[model samples]
Target: MGILNQAVQLAIMVGTIRTLSWPSANESRNANPPEKAVHRQIGSDFDYLMLTRIFPTAVCRADDDSVPDSCEIPTDTPEWSIHGLWPNFKNGSYPQFCDGSPRKFDSDLIKSIEGRLLRMWPNLYPAKTAHSFWKHEWEKHGTCSQNHKNLSSELLYFRTTMAIDTEYSVGSALERAGIIPRSEPYHLEDIRDGLMKELSHGMHVQLNCLTDKKTRQILLGDVRMCIDKSFQPIDCPRSNAFQPATYFTGHSAPLPSFKECPPLVTYLLETSTEPSHMLGLGHREFAYWINPLIPFYTGFFSQQKLKHELLWGITVPFMAVAIFIYVEGGRGG
Candidate 1:
């Protein structure tokens, strides 16, 4: 919402939408994110990246109808696609924007592997948006990972992820175990148990979901499993699954809930118009929905209040009058 808000402001100022790319400031290498003392001093070294994948169209479409212009979900794209490979802290506080490397991400690096990524990590929003998903991932998570640990550079990170995704295609694993997505809802354990049999190590994974708040129907979102520094998928530590920061630390800090894969989830196939961008915002703008007043607010009610005045300062109203002599004055003689 903030990104679009800024874009709209820029559009207002420049009298044009401009190109999808963000202005010079955001494009530059990220300014150093403030350091977290505890994270740095305790010396957080993540055991692994929870390489996750999601069936965006399924979960996103179940919840939203608007697809962005930038979307291109390949017809052959099987199962779920790469969500992200998140670096998990031992205490569940993951590192982000880790060292502030000066190197800016090169978008062209992804061109050669475009087809693979589109099937795997295509943008979920702003259908016609700047191909910023790769950049966002690099800036947010990839940079946090160390070179010797696993991912070395931008290309290496993307390539390694692709390799991992290829090796353990979540959809294939599930289908091999007789678990396929359909219209019916399934229990969390059933889906988890099915994947466990197919995976080599019987990985400990979490099933993320996007639930319809009104209908209370949980839709499967992402499948996240732990991968060691060697890039092998492994059983995720329970601590990493639900970081108990609040319980262990006993601070006022709120604990992160495990809502992504709540109980009683569904695996419904989407049957709607397939637009290009991520679904949540395109069909219905997320910003307005979050306000909690959308149900009561009407377009007709708000339209009356849209007026604006052009004056920069206070204004005083006055009336003008005109007088004219009648032709009867000459006829009076």
Candidate 2:
């Protein structure tokens, strides 16, 4: 009986250790299936938050078909502006339209900074309401980050986002590195190196591109950067999964050819007076879907799912069984 009791304790300890040591499925596997992707109460699920900023000119260029006249351009100076600040796991799977949060998005909550948000985070299409873009961002991404005090409420989330956006301007960084809007194409590596030089502190960015189907030319689209829970920049995790669409409308049937940028990319201004050296392209809407539950890292999870789930499912049960056997054996003795 004494031996059995010792064995039970040892088993519990081992189980606990394994649970702690095991890499989280959230951080290893592709995202859980859409149905099971409920927002867990904000603990250990996310590694860092991603700040996705887009080139307005490129976005406008892509939207030529849907609302060509509606595409908003930053005229004062060309700038890369906020797309959304998403809570991302290390593996790249992110929870969207998070469940169980009663907090509804209120435009009034962020009235104090509406002016700033307009300049920094406007919905590229002017046909949408002033708060339309912001509301979607809050519900789809900001809600998942409520656990942090700095981002606990809708107001704080937008405010915090603006503060971060101001601190880190991808356009400024690129310009400092001498990579600005130009008709000539740039080597993708040079763009990466330029960003690294300007946004130092071990900064890393993921560059996405808009592909012109007509010419098959790649245009610089957006740059995604990661920040830890405390909001310090961190190297983004690698994943080649299909990211969620930025627009509220369901993905277009003939989706705009937006994908990872190729080796050479054109960083031309959409409003450029010069005749476009490349053919014009159609746009993908950037609105919020009522329930855009798509996972950004689809292919990344399949490989690690079985191992992570099996071990996690067994850990607690095995420990319980060990304790029960020990108790029963002591009684028999």
Candidate 3:
């Protein structure tokens, strides 16, 4: 009887350890993202390039019209991830789907720097793999830049984006200016000034914002900066070139407006109660294995089927153990 009790306790301990020890960031790097189909279009000349960085927390929580289902919301630490590095014309028009006849988005080209890309330029929408997002960017915007020597190849384009992304990180700039992410709102001018003060060569950046439908409050979206053919920082054109183009998200509706933010803008931060990004699993799965009693996490487990599955997964094992212990005690008595 003593041996039986010891065995049960050992099994439970092993299970707990296995459940708690999820895969590390280093272990989950074998993700194979799918490729996208490219269409043929006439190529055109471009004046300068634009690099866009997205604030994930704001993107996930702000939009009420069509929120992404599986956004990779980061931890409490604020960071902006890459969207794309685009080639644009002077008149705010950009070419897309240019002729990269021999070149496709070869994942092999970026294998050496895959880890860095995953960290710096992760796809916010998890329903789609990061590869899919990269392929889309390459096929749509990157191909257009083949005319430029530095951005002619797929590897060069991605490498350039990563280098520039690190050099001009919006999160780091904001933190330096004492504008950290929080539930509280910040004045639009303070946000703009903080970003501009840190830029080099008096370079200009465009600030874009989204409106939360429920509260009708403004939230940060993308921070865009332009660069010349020499890859040096330059002020964005004074024209409406900052206006988001149609190809923004594949949605015909107009993209979020620039310089239209309210006086006060909300910059959301991840709450301690919610799951972090390194869990290597979906929110529902993490909640089920880690803590099934968190009723407050109902927002995460909104699907009825998912809730039932989680309930069964958590309750059945404990119930079986309880029954086994009761039978052994009765026999001993």
Candidate 4:
């Protein structure tokens, strides 16, 4: 009885799958032409985040292979070296951001000064600007004396209003574009919320516009891979929530459900009163359907293991149905 039932289910799945036309060679070619043929925006919120945060952090940490338990420098250190020197000092130069008195010192002393400045200022200067500052400092301070002509020059250059204005201008641009929002901003929660909201909206638009099934699938798989690779592991209680529209609205709808009646159907039934019932799936249904496919949508489940479980749970069933159908069709024929 089990074998017969399985065969029947398989046949049904095969029939449904066959009814959905796969893209032909010509159609496939037409759907995805050369990059020049299709006009695509080269940027996204994720790209912005990567350019602003991930990439910079990666570059900063790359210099130091060791992973510290905390980002905070010890009290004695007085400065944390991110990519190069202290925050106040430019990259590749000694620090000179002393108090009222300019401390004249050799390369080693400069290094210590830079370290102290880093602890004090943290992110006082951008990496690039800091590098330039260091260059000037090196040239000016290579020669030192009690009169301290080199120290005087370095101090004068740092204290100049033009340099300060330039740094502020650059930092302001980064902040405006939602890069480095602030040097020492206290609103990490706000930043994360804004980033996630922007990412969700961007992903939705991109996935929605992708009409080619193979391309869409490939893109989705790539997205899932990224999520798996990037996030860390954590433990938490699981929720059985699902969205209907993103799943049932597309070619995936006709597949047999693992559940007797999918949550999607219930969601649809609830919102059936609307006039545009068939125009597109309801929000709940859409959310239910797309939720499994979009890793970003599962923001609450930040843990890596939960993410994998959610993805595997959705995909395994769907793929199993597909495989069963393909195998059954061969036997029947």
Q: Whole-model Cα lDDT per candidate?
A: 0.54, 0.64, 0.64, 0.26
TM-score of model number 3: 0.62
Error of 3 at 231 (Å): 2.1
Clashing pairs in 3: none
Q: Write the per-residue lDDT of candidate 4 for residues 235-275, one digit (tens) a residue.
A: 11122111111111222222211211211111111122211
lDDT, model 2: 0.64
**Per-candidate TM-score against the hidden true structure:** 0.59, 0.67, 0.62, 0.19
Task: Please give the range of 10 consecutive residues that has the lowest summed lDDT in model 1.
Answer: 316-325
Error of 4 at 153 (Å): 1.1
- Name the better of 1 and 4 by TM-score: 1
lDDT, model 1 = 0.54
Give the CA lDDT, 0 to 100, for residue 282 in model 2.
16
TM-score, candidate 1, is 0.59
Report residue 76 deviation for candidate 2 (angstroms).
Answer: 5.2
Off by over 4 Å in 2: 1-44, 65-70, 74-78, 99-102, 212-216, 240-242, 248-257, 270-333
TM-score between candidate 2 and the true structure: 0.67
**Residue 29 in model 2: shift from native, Å?**
3.6
Residues 1-333, candidate 1, lDDT per residue (tens digit)? 999999989878765433322222332223222332112211125556778777655444433333223223444555577767767744445655555342456778767877777766765444323356777667666766655344766777788888888898887888888776665678888888877777636877877666543245677766777888887778876644342211112212121112556567777544321222322232123333434543343343345554334121111121010001111111110
Question: What TM-score does candidate 4 get on C-alpha atoms?
Answer: 0.19
**lDDT accuracy of residue 314 in candidate 3:** 62
